[model samples]
Target: MIQTRVFPGWRVVAGAFVCMLTGYAVAYSFAAFFGPLEAEFGAQRGETSLVFSIAAFLYFLLGLPAGLVGDRVGPRPVVTGGLLIVALGLVIAAHASTLWQVYLGYSLGVGLGVGFSYVPSVTAVQHWFVRRRGTASGLAVAGIGVGTLIGAPLANALIARIGWRDTYLVLAALTVLGAGVAGLLIRRGPHFYGLEPDGEAAAAGKASPSSSGFTLAQAVRTGPFWAVYTAALLMSFGLFTPFVHLVPYVRDIGLGSGFGVLLITLLGVGSTVGRFLFASITPWLGRRLSFALMLIGAGVMLVVWSLSTSATALVFFALLFGAFYGGFVAIAPSLAADYFGGRALGAVIGALYSGVAFGALLGSPAAGYAYDFFGSYAGAILAGALLCFIAFTIMVLAPEPARWLTRRARSP
Candidate 1:
């Protein structure tokens, strides 16, 4: 049992940090496996991209139920079970001999596992910190960026040292060791341990009002929810194109071989800085404007990228664009919590991210098809920028729900 004397919510944050780090690390590492899988499967780029889309699909699509379950039961069971599934998936992928088996074991298994763990970890953080939701969420989701940083280089190193097959096996062990222990430490909220959301200090003084926001059905009924969803869909559609294709895109641009995989590293570094930077300032800037600004910044970067000629230009574009993109990801949950209130935060966030999942599913393969058809990434890059601009427009025009404003007015 966690002690009541400590801020248990921070413990939840710590646990979530590890779970996200492990889960996303494994997912992003798919890029490292990309070349190997292409050779082994003898599949087209689009087809190979489908494997990731399928995994991402199940991961996001399942958020509705997973969030609902976490809201009702607890996050621990959901997360622990998901980590176990991740381990199983990695093990299956490690030994598979066919593409279908890879789809089944690696894509389906890891996707579902990540979905289960992700919603719960993110939602759990909101429950723990009402005053600092933005900061806490930034710290939590920063794991994805950090994992990308670690996972990309680590996966490449592992693949080089052993082999892709054995690499999966090693990942399986780490997933079980790191994520499993972290998942065990996570509890839903401070209330679970007989402490308040921000621990005894805030509880003894004036506790922030729990949000009286929309339930799932009512939330879906609103225009703002759909607007946010549309923006997310568009943003994700554009953003994932770079993430999935940047490595190959680098190689395609005639950059030296040494720099192909290093793009992920550069993007990771930029995102980490962006995540922390944005989270720290969001409280002052407000969620809506901050989000809109990030989107716009990212859009401009993409536009510049379409014209980049040299490797130096691409690297600079990648770092700046990745920073803006990372900041956007960190703020998403806070935006949801801000709009909907903290009542159904888990479920609302999960539903919102469903858009991200769908976007990735549609966007990545579409980008690949563009490459196959046009023989260049220029078309796709421009399309992504267009999507980001559209999302920024919606963010500027969209109105916040009355419930959220009322809660803010009441806050001390």
Candidate 2:
């Protein structure tokens, strides 16, 4: 009797999933901590929101280097080091006596930590699959939705029981244990194991030691690259505003904090579902088209969110917005892979996300400041909606890469 072993690619996907779940859970849990941190620090909404903005900005900006390094050195050491940094940041945040301390500890630490780990982990997944790339990518990033689902409420409950300071410590421990272990499971690519992508047996004539794909320099010069980058930048301006503000927004509308937490939870549930649901349909809808539709849908949802005052309306907004948001997150990498190939995908993806870093840096804080001035989030929400629409237009109008067009012209 012959025993057939499971493909190692699935293991890679599993590890990437856990890493994304743990890292993003820690990142998104800031919503649960928002009100408490504001009260504890005696800070304004803008100040409080800036912490999250800074962290988001740093992480996305650092992604370029992290991806570059991961491509060179592999993901394990980079991811493990990043997770440890997140733990340290959390520890410092737990001990914070001043708001500046929170910035120093949480903003820099968690920002840098997630930055180092996220791109590398996601990039590693791209190297492992071809046939099931969309599904695999969705599954790996679905950890983010699951993490958001678990992290926010868990933080809220823990803070209720143990206070915010101790809650940070608890999160720190969880990041170390969970993400640390997951990072170890990442391998560079299938070639390292004498296998091809999707676990196809390597044929003598077809075997390639390294992934075949565009280099960072070549990818950057393509029209599709800039289109994707521009769209990402615009979408991000609205994309993260809810994550940082939805809890507060619910409260501002006279809902209880618990209700706010519930909204965040619903967002997570929707996000998880969207990742699986959208990725499954990409083969038919096409990755680019699916992403464009989701972008427009997210924008429309923001308009609904701006007008929503009732709990029921807000619930609808959160679920649909989350689904669109999560779908795009899962699809973007696969789309990039479709255009650019996997050779230097980490760097290509990283470079594209650098646009997001700027948008995130501006978006959340701008919304917070708008609330401070206007005494409502209405203007910010509407502006976010407009940005999303513009992003959708840009994405839909963009042409395919010349290389892909040429390849198709030559194909039978």
lDDT of 2 by residue, 1-412 (tens): 1124988888878888888888888889999989999999899999999888999999999999998999999988888888889889999999999999999989998899989998988888889888889989999999999998998999999999999999999999999997667876888888877788888877777745347768999889878999899999999999999999999998888998899999999999999999999888887878888888888999999999999999999999999999998899899988888888888888998999999999999999999999999899989989989999999999788765444658745999
TM-score of each: 0.93, 0.96
Query: Any runs in candidate 1 off by more than 4 Å, and if so which?
Result: 1-5, 201-211, 400-404, 407-412
lDDT of 1 by residue, 217-277 (tens): 8889877788889888888777777667777777777884347568777778888889889
lDDT score of residue 316 within candidate 2: 98
Query: Superposing all C-alpha atoms, what RMSD in Å does each candidate have to the true structure?
Result: 2.9, 2.3
